[model samples]
Target chain A: MSSYHLDHLQHLESEAIHVMREVAGEFERPALLFSGGKDSICLLRLAEKAFRPAEIPMPFLNIETGHEFPELIDFRDRRAKQLGAKLIIRTVDDAIARGFATPKPGIVSRNQLQTPVLLGAIEEFKFDCCIGGARRDEEKARAKERFFSFRDSFGQWDPKNQRPEIWNLYNARLNQGENMRVFPLSNWTEMDVWEYIKKEQLEVPTIYFSHERDCFRRGGQWLPVPPAHTGATTPDPYAGARPTEKEPVKRLVVRVRTIADMISTGMIESKVHSFDDIITEISAARVTERGSRADDKASEAAMEDRKKAGYF
Target chain B: MSATISHSRPPVSHPVDILRFNTCGSVDDGKSTLIGRLLYDSKSLMEDQIEALERSADITGGGQINLANLTDGLRAEREQGITIDVAYRYFATPRRKFIIADTPGHVQYTRNMVTGASAANLSIVLIDARLGVIEQSRRHTCIASLLRIPHLVVAVNKMDLVDWSEERFIEICDQFNEFLPRLDIKDVKFIPMSALNGDNLVDPSVHTPWYVGPTLLGHLETVHIGSDYNLNGFRFPVQWVNRPNNPTDRQLHDFRGFSGQIAGGIVRVGQKVMALPGGQTSTVKEIWTLDGPLPEAFCPQSVTLVLEHDIDISRGNMIIGLDQLPGTGMDLHAQVCWMHQRPLQRGKKYFLKHTSNTVQAMVTEIDHRINMATLVPEPAPAELVLNDIGEIRIRTAKPLVYDGYATNRLTGSFILIEQGTNATVAAGMLLPSEQLVRPESGDYVI
Candidate 1:
């Protein structure tokens, strides 16, 4: 007999899958929030389970900060093609070149620059809802977020005017120029994501498998040495972006299981080499996956603050 | 294994053993601190998080990490040192992962607790050993029973303060056991523990050697929640009508599928299902997951089902297995936990949100309001006051396909949405159809 009840795991999965299908069925044009991270990967698998036999239905929407790892571009395309889902790349570079997104000098992180790019893509495609794999347990600010998070025309999440999600029933209704940021995996814990990945044998980026890479230490976090966080004098090709140096570099044997943009994803000094070894290390680990995420390590409600600023 | 019998084992296998439960009780009962002890002792705390805890130690609350802050994060809540919102925390053992809904114990936040406990399979009610079982404990436990939580655990916390007295523990245990039968809870496990000293959380303490029960976390990790789902019946509520209207694409253009997450049972391709509201029988032709085709799709898997016959169906319509069908009626009898500041009075109309369907409903009658202290009915009061748990009859505009909350959680529960603000004010668990009374608001004035 199949040892399956709609318990927490199944319940979370069901809710996510259901929400994913609702997006496909309800909206004319929709896109996914892909960051080449664990949460987005989990969202990819769920999207796969949601629209299987056909395709993921929607296209991959990446709000490129122009600061992402070069390897992510390859991994993102490879997986998108593997599932035959459409890949839609909208970059902060385009936003800055078109005067949509702007960035300040001496700042290497394009985390804040992605908002205009995202909002531009939404307006371009007239996307009604953007499906993301954000979990409420990831941070405290997220703890207060609604599943069907509302975003205005400017793509700002007004937490005070959030809709209520009662009894697994979601109100996905929206008006024109307004969009819903649906988090199907809102109820899932980080542990549930890993276990589901393992159980489903889902493929993720190789960087997540404890890969060895060249990194330099800055403020206790590892940056990919030279090219990363390079304070620039002139305008970058991707418009309005200028990589700046904060301090002198200190090289280390750094490895980050989860990869974000090269400028922000903090690398940990881990010697664990294989997926099996990583799992073992994670089993006894006390810190959260986002702990090493240099971007989130900035403030207490960093994830929340970014999310409210329309950063999925 | 037989060793893992859950609350009233249903002899069925649930997909995953992982359980999401809530811990709710009054402030002094140490709900937050006890939960912190559970996670800390279970070794679920991450290195970075622990470090942060060490760095940002509570200044006003004794310079120690206010364990409650781990779950409670709202600014108003932190400033007042009270949990005003539902905070979720997750942890895992090699066997299973657990997510806890650490809800507020304040009277004004019963809605938050109800929201958290809505998805919970089991509920852990914490009680202060010195205070015994209080009103909050009874209210939460009663709601747990009403919500059809299969299992319950009552941690007699602060045992250290009470000197680990076995007699005192037994007396409270007996008091709980006496009321458990009345609340309709199928299973209960009692344990004595001190959250501050970390007794019987991860390891059974030597001080409480008289207690042979598993530690709080031990019971949580091993307790079977495998049979709590409604696998016998099949109910699917259509969330939306999937019609890919790309006229250029010949194959995709005409596809009309009623998409939804199956709420119960296994639906195989070619199986017959009776559509609700219209009672039309259709055969399943395809099951589309985000990935692709499936031979069989069961409850909780959000799969878009394609039926052979293109019958009339839309959102809010439910499709059920022809074999084990559900009861359809306009009158719903349910036990509701009043959450709003305004009392639930007779002759009032409220929005009833059941599953994916939302309809206007009027309270038919307030059968009885439960007296928490005595666990007895106060007959029929003038109104169902705030935090009042009572049975009520409701009438909706259209018929709804539902089962008893005891049978199917997805179909059997609903919320009362305030008509004015559209705020969800009450969470309800439906009783059987016969016991339900269709109250007419016109018959009685507020």
Candidate 2:
């Protein structure tokens, strides 16, 4: 008898593919939430595996913060085109302009504002399920999430009232106007994601690799210096007042551990360049991956609060 | 110089195989503390995490760095000092990675334990040495047995409280052995440890000089889980039919394949397979993966199998090997763990989701409910209340192809979703067809 076994990466891949295929089988109208981050990038690969010879039976959806890195947006668009899948983008800027969402004065982050926009997109498209890349190991609130997390008609997640998911038998049955946020990567940890990326040789934005860019120190972390003469002095839209004499900016070598909006995503000063380097850094790092995102650092339960409002 | 550099690096280069296990015990059995010690002693806890643990010590643990806080992530859980939900934690050593499903010990949250144990390869049933083998410990052990977990570790926790007496550990082990023969579990091991003081968790404890078994961490890394899955009977429930009609790509154009994660057994190219329910037989032309075509695929691998002939097959169909066919029936007898607050009454309809197939099913009869305290079946009750375990008969609208839960975990288990509320109300394990016939059938009144 021959023994058959899968390594950790292969096992995670198989589990993720199973989840993606379940979403494809159960839901009538489902969309993959592509954020162009490492997690979402892995989701695209899993989606391809789930449906392959056939185009993924769903479109790709992204709720943009509008302050996102140009490289990430470019990569997201290019990947969607390469897959020949339709990409639907709903922006927080558009939501604010249309009065559907109000930006908290002096708070430049559209992170909190993303909830309404995401819900709006769901309603407009009648997407019964939106596949996300949220991992349980990322945050405490996420650790409690079900693979097929239920959302009410108002797109609110009641953590205390989630349905019990057992084995691989997920209950994808939802009433009209109610939707589910499906996380195929629920079991994947940051190291697992990086390992899968290396094993699969998946493509991600170049920002993840080390590069020299004009950056400045704020909140004890590096922030990219916006291009000169773009007329935006402050990186954050709600950064109360323009610094008296623009906080000293310098060109520094940095890399991003995670890709979020420029105003919130922090840069790590490192010479690490390749996937192996990132993996080694993560294995020895002191802080959690989300620890770098200033948005999550705002409050202890920031992610939990946003999730309750249907933020992906 | 090269040899010195290579020797300094860890022996394993790529990612090691993962072991998923759950810890179940009453609130004070030190389940969370055991997990905390495992991570902390292994150097898995980050520096900042340690700092945060120290900072929150004053609020949650009265100035002592509480290890239980590592698994209890919810605010209410921390405030109440109890685990509320199943929190997953990850840690890795050089040999293997591990995913720990820290389930709450409260009896009301038995559904969480079932959910966690459903995917776990092994289950750790913690028992307090001072209170050797309590009712909660028995209940959790019975649940693990019912779930058919391959391995069970009876961690005799808090040995330090009992003066590290080998007699106490042996007594508890003998007590567990007395009732364990009634269950279906195999590969049971007992380890003595103090989760609070980190004795025998990751390192050898000086306190317990007589114990000879491997430490908890060592056992986890070395357990033989490679044969956990069934490899004889091939079963693939078609999740979706992949049909990418891209004109630009020749390879994708006019391609059709049945895609799903293989539930059991092995499938290879040119192997003759049959699609259940439809009874369509065809030869496997190729097994496709993201990388390319594979020569063969086995259980738990998600792959697309191309058939030699195009059949009228779609989602909810199972592809099986010709040798050992699964039982097909509309009437199924199963052991169900009721999860909802509302009692499971006879004649209530539900959406029975098994594998990728969902069918309308109604409870025909409730045979008996097992008393977790005694591990005995109490003859047919009025209805199964929340967290009640009982055997019941179900009649589905469509015939389902399945094996007994003891044979194949993926193909044999299902969940019942309430029709109106859409809440998953029960997790059910199907019994073999021979056991499906009710002994009371002859006593039925005309």
Candidate 3:
């Protein structure tokens, strides 16, 4: 008799695949929220396992903050094309130009601005459900989220009034105009994601590995320094506010631990190069994965506030 | 093992075992505090997390640091000094990884507790040492049993408040054991500890010299949950049909497979299987995992199964072994825990979602409500209010393949959704179909 058992990584993969299939079966207009991050990359692999022999039942949706890493954007588009899935991109720059969102004065980071663009895209595409790669272990607010999170007609999430999800039965019923944000990787931790990437041999943005780049220090984190002022018509908003003389720009060898907007995503000074190195580093690290994300460090309730405002 | 790594560091090479459990008790029984102690002592708390806890100490009042703040993430929950929702926390020791579902312990939040316990392999029922075995303790224990949780740990908290008396701990243990036999739970372990003072949580405390049992964390790390899954009858509720149909790749041109997570038992290639409701028989040709094809698959592992001959199978269809077949019927007798604000009344139609199948169902009769305090069945309750547990008879529009809750949780459990609001109103555990009320009986006339 063969003893069949799934290790932790395989178990998480199974659970995630099951959730993706559930989304495919229940929703008429479901889309995968592909951010080109490690978690989202894992989602793509799970999607392949879920609906193989057939195309992923839904399209790929991405909300682009114009300030995103060039590598991430390139990888996102190439992967989507390789899979032959429909890719829909919505930009924060367009949301600002259309008067749907207004940039806060002197605030160059478009992390908060992406929420409106995402909501607009959802409304325009009439996506009944959007599958995201958000994991509960990422933040405190995320820890309270349900597997099948229900959103009101306005896309607002009421954390206190979430539907009770019992066993494997997910309540995916939504009224017209209402939507659901499905998270298939809710139970996965950061280590699990990296281990899975290694097991599946999935490709990620090259920036995740060690590289040399010009960087600057701000708020105790290393951030890539923007190139010399390119005098364009738009006039980059971030250039308007330069780093103080106390925080000098210098060329350094560093790598990004997470891929987000280029302005807010922090680079860590490390010699770690491969996925194995990353797993070892993460196991010995003291800070949470989101500690490097300046967007979430704005306040204690930063994620909760964004979630309430319909941010994925 | 590497010599360069320090002995104090967590062992990373061990095969990681995942344990999911929930903590439930009365509001002030220190459920959250016990979880915080476990995480803190296990060295799972990061430097930033400890700093955050220290920073919020002033806001939460009391010169002392409030450990409960770790699990209570929501602003409202922190301000109200209570856990209002189920917040999941992950931590790991050298031995195992754990997912802690810190559920609200208030009486009105029974639905939240039920949600937390639904997927737990074990349940920790906290009891205040000063106030041994109260009504809330009994209520939570009954719920743990109803959910069919395989393991139970009765943590007698606040042992310091009771002067660390061995007699007091024994008294509480005796009280719990008196009622535990009535429930179906087989394994029960009791421990005396103080979540606030950190006694006997991760390390054995000198104050409890009279106690000779594993520490709370020790037991959690070594508890035998290997046999929790049902490995007797093969049942696979198809979640999707994998048909790639890619023309360029010759191998993918004609691939068709039934995809789902195995809910029970072990399935091997060449095994004879039957599709439920259709009664179509076929032999399993191959089992496919994400990595590659496998010769055999077992319960809880999601895999795609290829059959020798394709019969009519789709989502909501169950593939099972012919030997221990599940009951097929339209009438179901079940025990339901009402979760909605509106009372559950007879004659109301609902969307009964069992496995992947959803069917229109109606509450034909309300048998009786179980009084949590007395553990007695009250005859003929007119309606089941929010958080009430009662026996009910339901009739579905189509036949459902199922087993008794005692036999198989995945195949036996279901949720009732209100047709209009689509809100999940109740969670139900099916009784055996033989006990189902016959249509010819006088009860069906209503």
Best by TM-score: 3
Best model per DockQ: 3
Candidate 1 chain B, poorest ten consecutive residues by summed lDDT: B1-10
Candidate 3, residue B261: CA error in Å? 0.8
Clashing pairs in model 3, backbone N/Cα/C closer than 3 A: A53-B243, A53-B244, A54-B243, A54-B244
Name the 10 consecutive residues with the lowest summed lDDT in model 2 chain B.
B1-10
Query: In candidate 1, what are the lDDT values of residues B335-426, reduced to their tens digit?
Result: 88887778896778987877778788999888898887787988777798777888888888777678788888888888887776555567
The TM-scores of all predictions, comma-separated, are 0.85, 0.95, 0.96
Q: 2 or 3, which is superior by DockQ? A: 3
Residue A294 in candidate 3, Cα distance off native in Å: 1.2
A42-140 in candidate 2: lDDT tens per residue? 999988888876778899999987777889999999999999899999999899889999988667678899999999999999999999999998877
Off by over 4 Å in 2: A229-246, B1-12, B246-253, B435-446
Order of models, best TM-score first: 3, 2, 1
User: What's the TM-score of candidate 1 when only chain A is evaluated?
Assistant: 0.87
Q: What tens-digit string does per-residue lDDT give for candidate 1 at A1-312?
A: 254544456667877877787676556788898877778988998876665444467888887877777677788888888877778889887788899777777665788888778888888888888888788877776777777777876788765445545567555556668788888888787666776777677776666655556665565766664343345986544332222365545555556655667777777777675545566566555467778778777766566567677877
